[model samples]
Target: MALVGPLLAVVVLTAAPAGVKAGELPWPKWLVAGVVAAAGVLVAVWTPLVKARTDALAARTTREAEREAQAEAALGRLPTLKRKALLVRDMNDRALLGIHEAIPLPTDSDSDNTLSAELPTYVPRDIDADLRAALEARSRTGGFVLLVGPAASGKTRCAYEAIRAVLPHWRLLMPPDGATLNEMVAGDADLKHSVVWLNETQNFLAGEDCLKASMVRRLLADTTKPVILIGTIWPTFYDQLRIRVTTADEESEGGHAFDKDARGILELARRFSLGKWSDQEWDRAKEMQSVDPRIRQASLHRGQTGLTQILSAAPELVHRWEQAETPFGQAAITAAVAARRCNHPENMPIAIIEALAKEFLTDFQRATAKEDWLTDALMWACRPVHHSGGIAPLQAYGKNMGQIDGYRVSDILVDHKSKSAPIPDGQIAPDIWETLAESATPQACLLIGMGAYSAGVLGVARSAWERAANTGNAEAMAPLGVLLHNEGDAEGARTWWQQGADAGNTGAMTALGAMLHDEGDVEGARTWFIRASNAGNANAMTNLAGVLYHQGDTEGARTWWQQAADEGDADGTAALANFLYDQGDTEGARTRWQQAADEGNTQAMANLGVLLANKGDIEGARTFYTRASNAGNANAMTSLGMLLSREGDAEGARALWQQAADEGNTQAMTLLGIALDREGDAEGARALWQQAADEGNTYAMTVLGVALDREGDTEGARALWQQAADEGNDMAAQALRGFIEVEE
Candidate 1:
């Protein structure tokens, strides 16, 4: 427009002078000038190129101004809750797609060139990296993950972490306390790529079919938008794949409610996440005999289908768990034992509670026996936080909580010497260790690893107990004896064991009996064993029965074995299985073997694995055989080798048998010798057979005898046969008889 005005003025000036000269009766000077000006303006008006360029310039100028204004507005809106009111909201954009609503596109005004430099953006919170990447790839893919916790255990905070991670560019959406569900999904379009975090969601769901609840139902049902529900309680969002983040109750609630909340935490620990033990802040859950008798024998394992139960009926257990550390893995072990106990009440007689406890200890192998004591201490420490609805969670501190039931949360936090930042290392160690020593002597500090406490714990189990014994406590003497025995000082163990037994410590009586047996003092062993056995030391009875059997006291052996088995010893069960197998009770033997195998005895596992295989349970056999191999069962190794060979893996089979042979397993050595022979290594096979024969393997002796006979040493072969015959090899006896008959 500026260019045209100047050009027109110049033309009008030049044309006005010319018009006066060219026209006879030219119009007035002013009129002629105006006419010339109008002609100059018309000159460019009809030119297509000029008009097109002019329109383009005008449009560009308008857009530039609009963009600058938009950027300024966005800068003004920086870091506020509501998004900059998109004044340029495009009506052309579609509202909804297939299931999810379409997120609107940024307008031209959002052009970076015009974006205000003053706008400061907030970054997303750092969180679980893998989940972050997945969400980014899917463009705000929305799904439900169950977030369960005892009240105030930080369930809400975790949900916020997920939301903050995914929506880095957006401002935080911290809904006011007691917000309606409608407010939650109100910004549906923006939240399509963001999360609608509903805090205290349970209260929103309290009255069903209400306007707020209806909004919640619709939002969840939409499935395309990410929605997070944070509540003090549990929720049900159906027909969706979900993840559960379970937690324990915060230290706030007092009285039975707090205890009940702790119980719920235990239930979540035991029932979810694959039955592994999870330590809560201040509680321990372990398997113990249930007060109810009917439940005592029940075989139903908890947490088998973990998240499944959580998504369905998890709310029921929210308040009943009382133990600090819930034994989650116990249920599976309990079920496994219950089935066996019910089936073979005599041979396989471990009660569900006993088996479950054994399973608990076995599963956590790296954990110490003193760790159990720690569990009890933690439970006592958890004793309900006294304050509720406080701004901060309570912290336990100081020498005297003074019967602390409930105190000011801030008082608890500030009262400690360290100002409640976590008890100082110097103080916590001494305090916990000192308090622990009251019940657990320093020598047996369960959770204390090798450190400053190592002197008190690992190397002092006996010394600490000795002081107790010197103070005239016989029970302490019993533990000292066990410690001495474990240290390989049998004489010292005997001394304490006798003292403790004279004081009527039954555990000491068993130790004395065991030491006597090891010393080849059978009469003394028998007397102590009787005392221990009568006191219900099943270990004593089992050991005594083995000795009786060796002495040809079959009736006495049977009596003790029955007594031990009835008391639930896996060893006793295996012994009974051996006897039954000899008596032609194959079914009874298999059942007993299976029972013993469940107790983690390698020999029983190998026996069961072999028997199950012969009975044509190939898959079950393979699985068992693998377990047995893991347990270092040599027979299982040889059996697995043959199975693998049949499956066309001869080399693999050879490697397995060789491993067992390397472990000095007689059966494995014998089988490896056979495998070597089959592979055309006769000398190597003979060498292996020699090793096995020297180990008193009768089958190996027969193989050696045959090898000697083949080498043209008939007398040497006969000698080998005689040795095998002495070891009860029927084939060897027949071979010797046949040779004698032939010679006669």
Candidate 2:
């Protein structure tokens, strides 16, 4: 009956649809309940999926924040060489087979090549005789010797002569480069008593070779053994090496080269210069060449004039090779030219040469394999280089422009005037500046600007810097600000630095902090200093520590200083040592000072000398003071003089004081005057005393006053004595009172 009623209602609605509207048709309540239950099921299924996605997004955001925090922490820490130890150690694992392949063993006619039993005849120069004696003396104690000279200056011959005289029974072991040398030392027990000679030693001493520094450290460490390490260097290469000079005098005096890497080498080695052959030596060399076959073969071109000719032929030979029709020669010449232009010598990696060949000599003949092409290139470069083995081994290569596999050309051929040492008042040519401004990249302009700055060409530097700064490159920011500051635009400098700081430049932040500190806005300086320090500026870390210490946060300051020292900052090490000394940790301070001194921190060297002297280690103190004084530390000169005087070497003390006075040290002037007075040089003593007195030295004033009184210059004596007494000089007071009594 229900089916029949529903059917009847549907039929009625369908029949009335054309003209009739009907009210709600109600049949059953069960249909409506079923629809509502289905909708609830759909809602239930979607809820968990949405919640899962939300949870995943939240977890991802948390992980990103944690990663950002870790990144910041890593950025805050300073770069250290600690990580390089493992890398340097691993470099020693390279096989030794390829290293010594460059320089073949000496060969005789149709016989196997071997070191000669007969002593190599050498035309004995003063330096050669000294080297020979020194080598013989240190043969049993594993001392280092550096033979530095110009190209073809017979340095290698000197090495051979020295080794033959010193270690006649010992085998000659010449590993190709620093890495192989280190490997040989580590793996071969026989090297303990052997003569290890490294020729063209600049290859090893370049800063990119960490293994070389490591090798020097190891050689210096075990000096008790009978191993002798000798190396020959080009004079130009030696000049290019980093020297840690702390004072203006040191720079002016052409400072001693003992950077972080070179320090160990310098400490262990006694340096000897092989001068160009004198006219007498050259004549003697001709006579020796007739008697000695070794000398005859080594000196094929004869003396210094012939050697210079051979060296000058390098670029000409390269040009000739380039002008040749053959692709191999052209490719070789191109690579050599590229290397020369880049200022890298003989340190070109094979792979880099090949890459360059591929780029520059794409259509070259394929008559030889790619390897032969590189060999040909080196073979051509070596043609004009006398006394050099025909080909450089792969190990001779070093980073070019900091690229691992790049190649360097022979430096002898390159026109060096363009890269000459900057003259203090040098001016860049108008054409040079125009070319640089017109064609150079932004980065290149910045480098040009730096060069100008170094050469004291301020106008050119400003122009270049302005050009670079307009590009909005971040590196130019702080340097431009520095130029502005130097030009007396303090507010402009601050504005530029602030802008750079806002752009996240740590250098600019440091510059701002330094300026503020100089201006006595210490609180503002601290804020900028902290920001730069947290961004991993080593200078800023030291600056922050200084400000913190000034503000009485001693512990916090100590923490920052320790952080800086751990990062291997020389200044930071010195500062930390001072802090430790203040805190009564003398031993700790000594350890830190030693570390800093070894790194060539001039202040640390002077400080270490003082500390060692206090500890009754006079010899150690003398060593440090001599090193610091050589680096032009006036304080060290004065201290060293005092020590020499204490040891009864008055002449030596006086000489050091004279040197210090020449460097504008008032204390040295006063002391030297006293020494001169004792030596009965009354006029010289008076002049020095007068100069020192003018510089506000109380002792000098009193001494000068007494000398003037003795010389009958009563008015001058009275004035000098009165001024000195006013400055709290007891001697001056006594002298002044004596003059007053005499006047009465």
Global CA lDDT computed for model 1: 0.43
After TM-score superposition, the amount by which residue 663's alpha carbon in candidate 2 deviates from its true location, in angstroms, is 3.4
User: For candidate 1, lDDT tens digit of each residue in 1-744?
Assistant: 000110011011110001111111121121121111100000000111234335545765775565455435433432332454221121111111001111111233333343222211111222235444544544444433334433322334434444455655533333332233343343332344334334433332211111232234334445465543323333211100021111111111110010121122112211111122133211111131132221121213233322212211122222111122334322222222222111111111122222333333444642544545433432333343222211222123334556422211211111122232232221333333322323332222211221212233434334445655765667566656655655677688778879988887655776676566556676676676666666555556666666665555656666766776655455666666655664568798778777766644455665565566556776877887788777666556766776686677778777877987887667567667766766678889889999988877766776677667767888987898899888656556766776677678
Return the TM-score for each candidate structure.
Answer: 0.43, 0.47
- The clash count for each model shown is 15, 2
| lDDT for each candidate structure | 0.43, 0.55
User: For candidate 2, lDDT tens digit of each residue in 125-197?
Assistant: 6576788788888776777789876654566665765666656666555454455554443332334565665
Off by over 4 Å in 1: 1-483, 551-556, 646-648, 680-683, 738-744
